[model samples]
Target: MAFVGVERAVRQILQDDADVFALVGARVNPAKAEQGPATPYVVYQMIANEHHEMFGGSAGLANALIQISGFSTSKSEVLDLREKVRLALQGQTSVVTVGADTFDVRSIHLEGDRDIDDDPRDGSDAAIYGWAMDFRVGYPEPVP
Candidate 1:
C-alpha cells in the first residue's frame, strides 16, 4: 500500500539531523532493523492512519500515529538517542521531500514514550535497552 509519507519523512528528518546522524548514522529502518544490526539504531512503523473526510467524501489530508524505536546496548546511549529523536521531530511543521515524494506536514507532535528492554534470545546475552516513542503526524494525502 502507498503511504501519505510520514514514514519516509521521519527517516529523512532523523538522517538529516546532525545529532541524530552522529548517533545512528544511516541505521534507520522502516519496520525492524536488520538482523544483528549495528547498535544505536532506529526503527519506525505506523501504528494507525486515518484519512480526513468531508461532507462529500474525502478530504485531501491524513493523520497518522507512528512509533519510533531507538535501540542500543547501553541504556545511556539509548536514552540519548531517544532524546535526539524527540528533539528532531517534536512540534515540526514543514514540506519534506523524500526522493521523488513530498509530504506537506501540518504538524508533528510527540504523543508518548516508554522504556523497553529486550531479553536476549539465548537467555545468556545482555539485554537491549530502548525506547518506543509515539508521534502524531498530520499531513496532506498523497496525490496519484
Candidate 2:
C-alpha cells in the first residue's frame, strides 16, 4: 500500500468499528468489546475475573486474552520471551515507539453510588441518577 492509499484506508477504517464475536460461539461465555480477545495461540493461563461463586462482568471477559507476543518457536526463545514480558509488564520494558487511536461516542453512563461526586452541603441539587453517551475506542495494550 502507498502512503496516500494508506492514509485513505485508515481514514475509512477509523470510520467503522470492528465487529464483535460471540463469546460462546465455540467457547463457553458471553462477549465483550467490539471484538473478542486478541489471539488464543499460546495461552499460559486463562484471563478471567471469576468471583468465588460466579464470574464478574467484562472484567472476566477482558482477562481471557493472554499476551503471547514473546512466545518463541524454540524453548529457549519461549524462556527469553517470558522474561521479556515479565520485565515489560513490570515497567522494565522501554518502548521504541508509541501509537494510539480514539473514537467519538454519543451517550455514556456513570454507574455506582460513588459516581455522585457532588457537594453534600448543597444537597438540594444532588443527583439520584444520570446518563450520557460518548464514543469509546479500545487500546488493548498501552502499558507496553
Candidate 3:
C-alpha cells in the first residue's frame, strides 16, 4: 500500500518553520474550502503520483506531485509565504516519521509557480492575492 507520510511530513515541516508559522499560524489545510479563514494562509493538495517499478513488477520508490498554494490580501505577502515554503521544502531529503512507519524522502524539487488572479469569494473589499507552487517529491515506498 502507498503511504501518505509525505503529505504529513510536508505539513509538519511547514508548520515547524518559524517564518511560515508566524504568517498563517496553523492554517495549513489539504484542499481547503473556496472561502475560509482570514488572509495569509496555505492550502495544499496531492496532485499526482508516479511509481517506480523494478524487476517482477516490484515498486520501491515513488514520486509525488504536490501543489501548495498561498493566499493573502496583498501580493507581497503571498509571494513571501510562497518563498518561505520553497525554502523549507526544496532539496530536502530526510526521514519523516509519521506514526510507527518512517518514510525516507529522497528529494523535493520545485516544478513551477503561478500567480492567481484576484477573486474574493467573500465579496469583501480586499483583493485576494494567491500564489500556486508545484513540487515533485520523491520518497521510498513501504515494503511488505
lDDT of 1 at 4: 38
Compose the digit string of candidate 3's lDDT tens values, residues 12-52.
77887899999998899888844657779898989998988
On residues 49-140, what C-alpha lDDT tens digit does candidate 1 reach at each position?
98988887778788899999999989899999999999999998987777766667799999899998766534558778989999999988
Please, what are the lDDT tens digits per residue for candidate 2 over residues 24-133?
A: 12111222212222221111222222122234323211111221221112444334333332322322111122134332221111111111121222335532221111
Q: Is candidate 1 or candidate 2 better by lDDT?
A: 1
Question: Lowest summed-lDDT stretch of 10 residues in model 2?
Answer: 19-28
- Compared with the true structure, all predictions reach lDDT values of 0.87, 0.22, 0.84
Better of 2 and 3 by lDDT: 3
Which model, 1 or 3, shows the larger lDDT?
Answer: 1
lDDT of 3 at 17: 85
Clashing pairs in 1: none
Q: Best-fitting candidate, measured by lDDT?
A: 1
Candidate 1, TM-score vs. the true structure?
0.90
lDDT of 2: 0.22
lDDT for position 97 in model 2: 20
> Which residue runs of candidate 2 sit more than 4 Å off their true CA positions?
1-46, 50-70, 91-144
Q: TM per model?
A: 0.90, 0.22, 0.88
Q: Count backbone overlaps in model 3.
A: 0
